[model samples]
Target: MLMLRLVIASMASSSLSFQEKYDVFLSFRGEDTRNTFASYLYAALSAKQILTFMDHELERGDEISPTLRRAIEESKISAIIFSENYASSTWCLDELVQILECKKTREHIVIPIFYGIDPSVVRKQKGSYGVSFAELEERFRDRMEKVHQWRAALTEASNLCGLDSKDFRPENKLVQKILEDISFKLPKYLSFNEQLKGHLIGIEKHIKEIESRLSISTKDVRIIGIWGMGGTGKTTLASVVFQRLSYFQFEGYYFLWNVREEYSRYGANHLRKKLLSELLNDESILRMDTPFVASPFINDKLRRKKVLIVLDDVDSSTQLEALVEGYYHFALGSRIIVTTRNAQVLKKVADDIYKLDGLNEIESLKLLNLYAFGKSSPPKNYAMLSNNVISYADGNPLALKVLGSFLHSKSTDEWESALNKLKRIPNKDILDVLRISYEGLDKGEQNLFLDIACLINQSFTRDDAEKMLDAGDSFTKIGLTVLIEKSLIECRKDNKLWMHDLLRQVGHTIVCDEHREPGKRSRLWDVKDVCHVLERNMGTAAVEGISFNMSEISKDIKMCHASFSEMYNLRFLKIYCDNIDNKKFKLYLPQG
Candidate 1:
């Protein structure tokens, strides 16, 4: 066990140590290439938000400075532009030697761009390159060892695969090509597994199914959809497939996350421009005035490039049209994956759809144990409690994780109390995620959802709930259908209406948000709040409904006319008193 702990610590430290400070480093002769080609390249990279280090001033020395060396060591990639006078300066040669050394030592990426210079001349040390080296040899005759190292460095760098400026016609075209190459070579900045909170229980099977659906080896466009409720891990699954399939064989790749939220916040035009800019590797596309203007540009530019794109959390079909119209908008062999909570959105554009379901009981327990104990199974002493928590979570990944984390270090008694509390009040983090689908409902649907969440869940059938709600039978039926489609509620084969515990808590909380005081709230479910309102005569017009289980309360309670008089809009009230004969509970009414 001690050795296992040490191994885990070491692995974590190693992961942290591998972080790169800069995305790219620029190596060029300031006098020869800085003002023209180098400047343009730096500006383009900076506009794309690529972290780069470029020395703007000229360095006057034969040896590379410590600061420059550090930059080379910290950068993930280095771009060496070999101009006419590149080899003439000992400073440039020394920088090149350091970059190549870092490449050999750290497995860094080195891109050599022969700008208006012959690759053969640079590789063989002939022509202008030879002339510059001769001058360096004469000047550094005493340091002949250093001059030899510089010559070897240039030869090695020039031999690697690189771009030649002469092959690309216009300067802008050359810049675009370089950007595209960099995009292809750059490592993924975001890790899909990391976003999953380090738990991927039961994900491998889904990934394999998605991989078979992709059929990436075929030379045809494929659009696959992943649909599920919130917290179902749809985004995580799609991200894993994307990262695994996106290889250097593809021309380009882009992942656009939170399409629904971002589109709502920044509008469809912003998303369209961002998509074009990222896939095309050019930030200038962001200047387009509207999505209509940008669509043609995207079609013209990306139609020939085979790429992989993932659009996550899409809520509408319009977002799909604006980003990727259809097969005609992309090159053959391209693949597009869209993740959404609505199946209707996928029916319009997706050729294949994969619907995600909740985790199984065994997987749920494993996930909870991993979060609480950092292992695959709970400790022997806590096995029963773990099972109980899993039962309450009902295979929901988010709830299991939240509850496990909350009860991680608590004592046995605390665990019992926490579980009891969870039966009444849900964890805030869990409620937040479950509330997203609830917030998306219309007012009528929202009311119907609250009725199920607060009073009807697991106890009442669909017909019973419809009879209780004030909306007409047709409107109530439509609302219930919408709720079911959105995964907010489920109807069992027995015709009983059911809701996830976390979602039920969210619905109750929404009604609670009307006011902090119990009497001012639209709904009341907690015994303490109900007792306070009834005992203190705090009932008010805001109290629309009240539901409580009297058996859970130990003391007897009595309510007079004042408790019911102030509630002018009281619509429904339910009290489950199993010990009514033992406890003296009374409700008095006023004369009409």
Candidate 2:
């Protein structure tokens, strides 16, 4: 078997002399699957220019060898081909030990490929394979837990789609599929093409250093925190960074969204279940009473393994504390990236802080054009309006998106009207524009949009939206499609939906108008203490349906309600303020 592997390894001689690094290291017991499976796998992988390293010579001694250990360390990814008799071999066990050690030192990625045996048997130390590991641990009883940990790693990986040796030969379609899956899992950015599409613009020197830290080998948990104001594009910056990380290049990678919102309801258990189900790509077996199932699924599987995890939109230190305990549970070379609106959040979890600055004028214009025209440049006729709109937007991407989306198909009259409304409104907050856009929508669209938007007030699911909206495809698919294209809402990679705070504020503003019951809106407000009235009576007022006058509030206070509907509501609500929010205010109120 060793000879066969050596013969195949030598076939890649064309690139061998230049000493280019090997892409994959194939490990297996020479006796069991090497001759039958590893040999074919080696040839096929090598054909694709994926380097394979396998020892050909039979050593004189039975002792573990240093040559094999070094080979395992230098390789970027180790593919351990586990067969029935794999654990019985001292040579294979030694290789396994070294592979695991290198994994701990952040030296390489390890993938345990179950060729013929069941993964759970290895993980639980069951059957013949389990017995072999047990014997090895007895010899090295002091390091018994380490031995078991390697077994657990194999089992955890096996939970992800397993390849059967009998069913999948190296050249078989299944083998190719598995190889491609592994290729995707390998460290490459989320979008290699996009990264190369054009050079990154306006990225600071420190940002590069943060990315460099991610690239370098390290044992400690590396945390990068990106902090900025509400409209400063913290999410976008973190997204670009996540794309660059090529987390799939590693053995385990996960991107978690809205950490602050989810933690509040589901607590750590829900998050653990999410990580296990989403990251592992496993079918959820979550039960409230048996949350421990999710913990063991992750802890037993990913303990001490290098993983790239992204926790986005973290608002509080408690959120971070709940999700990630410390670096100790993660394998060496693990990297975590966090994004938040709070600097204190960055200070808490981040080893280094990157304060995300607003986009430069050119970048801002480009972003606006992307939203307004779906192209990189402004149209000839719309350039003046576009420039005017951009100036009013003041370089906030969220504002640009909302404003551009509202003006996307409007005529010159509409553009002037919208722009005038935006200017007169004073608040000009992006969410305010979104609110106005919501107000401008026809009743059906407005209702559906507000339903989805308000559902995000506490961060609900699409199913929740489905139940709340109750209007079939119009509300669920078509309405969501329209909202997303309009840039009013964003669907996270995780199944949950997200409404920009601006958009949520807009939803609040739009709901506080002609659509809602006047009495309910009035009950929440007190026009006498008008400033506090507007501030405290915002979201609930929107829900109860009252549009308040924007001009009545001071400039700063108006800015707080800078959503489009709020400004539009001002046109009507300003005239009615004297009569609203009074204890004597009375109107029909919806009841359960």
Candidate 3:
């Protein structure tokens, strides 16, 4: 099979090097079917942006022109519309022979549409086919070999997969089937670029997990969901799997990226139209104004087709329903893969849910090293700094890539400074991407997220964090669970509340955005900012929470009672004085 594919690819590259100019070559008897079925098929293919060569001009003689022969070789597939009186034309027979030869040598696809006829009749030259062949034989009795060759070519073409107009109820239905068949056979539908071949590290394991869940060898319709945080490479892993499975002989395939964003931008109906147009290979569906109207159309057209579809970055059940609602809408062997940040969205629909985690420590380091140094290992003297960056990234691929690229060509001192600055301030590029998931949270969930990101991350247990929030017990518990389901936070086995560093940074940035000055902000963590606020009595009513690292400040630190008076809304406060003696640190609070 491998060798056969190689040979086919070589022949296609060599013979149809100009296939970009046309997708299909049409051959037919003009008087028999040109204005009828042939014209409809050509228009249908063209509506799908399929460039087809259909010769409409009157032929001067029986001999095939050089231009016609070139068109036959340049096309990726040939659609021969064999109708009554088709065999009477010697020119049509000659074109059929050339199409068959090209199919044999170049491995080009050949689809025979028996218009108002039967395959056995066309193959055996019986009935009207036989009558037309008898006339041609009598007229060309001197060129007996030519007549025999035409007969053999028709027999070969009739044996392949094709549509019979009689099998379909109406002519338009047959035209649709022909379009579907040709679109499925065309190679452009499965072409994925190879730019990420080497960059997809640690994706094979995820792909294997998905494949096992898919069980492609079985004839079951499987819907698998891959849920993970943003920048965890969910889309990357899905794309890799899509490309690998494209080699399978499925009836159709589509990889739709950024489903949530697309639906939000163009509305659900537009997305539905786009999905249907790509799957059915007909762009006319885009005219539909609402998903309610397109849903039934999709179910009717794609019900029996075995297709593979990947819906990436989906955020809601509405989006899923708008595209692919139920398993019954597709064939038995079809497979659908969906990637999302919200696990709750897949709970009711996915047959099996795979929660994608960040890369492991080793994989994270290797990825950072590759991006920073263009290799899999760090430079000789930069190992410590590299390890620091890896520790800060905490296995998040986006953070590692951003930090690595930022520190790529810097000196040791610069690396140290950047690492230190990152400890206090996260990279904006990384923060912006990670913030998307946070921004999707509701107001209550956003408050809980900020609480964890700014103050409770890693330092407090889940129960302790919930107590600090001061909301009702049930409300706080459900909010935290929602955060976990959203991939924004996780509860460790040791009962600690954990969140990705980049996500923590995002939360901190959100709080910081409320006020440029730390004293005016709702949350304050920096020691210098805290001391400045205390020493200058700059505290404000806007401050909802404040924390001071006393160990990082002077032992002679003192605060005025008036500073605490100004913080009228402060509900949460922490003072870390590990290095200083208790008596040396003085705090003055007003007596209410």
Candidate 4:
């Protein structure tokens, strides 16, 4: 079985070497260590799906073969196992010389494994090593320079930092150490190309903040949460951080995406099995049509290994219980990064939380220009128009991306028309994501959010909002907190109610969705909509609240009580103007 595996690997390696580089190159004497430590090393590397070149055929030559030398050069790392009689083989010596030459010239990584033989013996040509060199000198007496080169390569290769078999009692322990050292130094950066597809503007600082919270330098297992509103780049930041840092110290890694959707669709049992199968690298589990049954074997296997896991788009407590809470005890130095819009969900599980924000002005502009103008900055003629779109985005990456894509090749007149239309109708893609947090709320919370949204009050205090909406202070405060935690709204330093422009647009879209007609809508905040309802006395019983900045209308416009007669359920009415000239417009109210 072992020989067959090696033959297959050698064939695969030979074919791969034509176009691909090996993750590691293993060099060892076949008779002394091939079936022992060398076999175990190759098995370990192969299990990790790390491509390795191993000479399955017996060594019979005094010089390294062309294919063997090319394999050494193509490999990113070389693991040389110096066992008893390792220096006896000329082929091993030739392989070592080639490995070291590549190391010196290509700056490749070379790992020297002292397999039961002290590194000092290999370094200084002591004991059996000296006898091996003496024999080599006798056999190659005419070519003494070749023997000198072998001695120099051994001394130099043995000086590298690597696993010493003496320290690791059980031979498997040494193999484990070797596998980890090679994995960490593999430099798997290119895989991020598929993970991060779009403009990565403004993500560096976020990645740094998340890494700080992860505490990767420590050995403690930590659950770090990337908490923020939907479409704020939490998932994108997590993906980048996972790709770059996950390979640094982790032994196994699995990135489980759409945890909420998957859990909801497949149930806890299936997700657990999927997690185990992927983390354990067991393909048979997936091949089974039924979900793999849970057992202590799953937990026991995970408990011993250090891994990096990412659970993206986690929304429910059930998902936390099944995926995270079930396997929270990963080995020390293990880290799990979870991305969610709900702070409460993360608060229950995460050891440290990084509150992610959307793009800032400069980043928003750059990202917009990338999608809109296909450059880092907008064309000079479109600078002002570009700023206008950025202002509408207000640092929200989703909105910037959607709006930029929408305005990609449109004319200036189209840009103005689209911006105007956006004020009345939010982008569907951006609105759908923003609505997720809002939809998770209960009926009361939704009503409260809609009321706040219709208020369009950038500075509504908690007390002022409750008094105006008549929702009671206690109810309003709790609803506001929930919105804040979900990141649908924010209570800034001024302690006033605030929300993202896109979120506010979401609220507008929702009310608009309740009814197509302006008068029949549950809330009326748009100046044109309210004016349409008032000027025509089209107010219907569906109207619950109306806010109008009369200063936006003609000074001579007049509103009478009969206009709102049908709006008997209208509980809140706000009509105010910014200037004294606004008071000239007349407003007549019904007598008590």
Candidate that beats the other on TM-score, 3 or 4, i.e. the better one:
4
lDDT of 1 by residue, 224-253 (tens): 998877787888798877766664446778
Give TM per candidate.
0.62, 0.42, 0.66, 0.71
lDDT of each: 0.81, 0.60, 0.80, 0.81
lDDT of 3: 0.80
By TM-score, is 2 or 3 better?
3
Candidate 4 Cα misplacement greater than 4 A, ranges:
1-197, 283-294, 470-473, 590-592
Q: What does candidate 2 score in Cα RMSD to the true structure? A: 21.2
- Model 3, range 234-307, lDDT digits (tens) per residue? 99888877766643436778899999889999887787778768878888787655443645766777877888
In model 1, which residue pairs have backbone atoms overlapping below 3 Å?
none
**What is the clash tally of candidate 1?**
0
What digit string (tens of lDDT, one per residue) describes model 4 on residues 270-319?
77767768778886666667655656876787788899999998887678
List ranges where model 1 is wrong by over 4 Å: 1-198, 215-222, 248-250, 289-301, 403-425, 531-537, 550-557, 561-563, 575-592
Q: What's model 1's TM-score?
A: 0.62
Clashing pairs in 4: none
Question: Model 2 misses residue 22 by how many Å?
Answer: 25
In angstroms, the error of model 1 at 44 is: 24
What lDDT, from 0 to 1, does candidate 2 have? 0.60
TM-score-based ranking:
4, 3, 1, 2
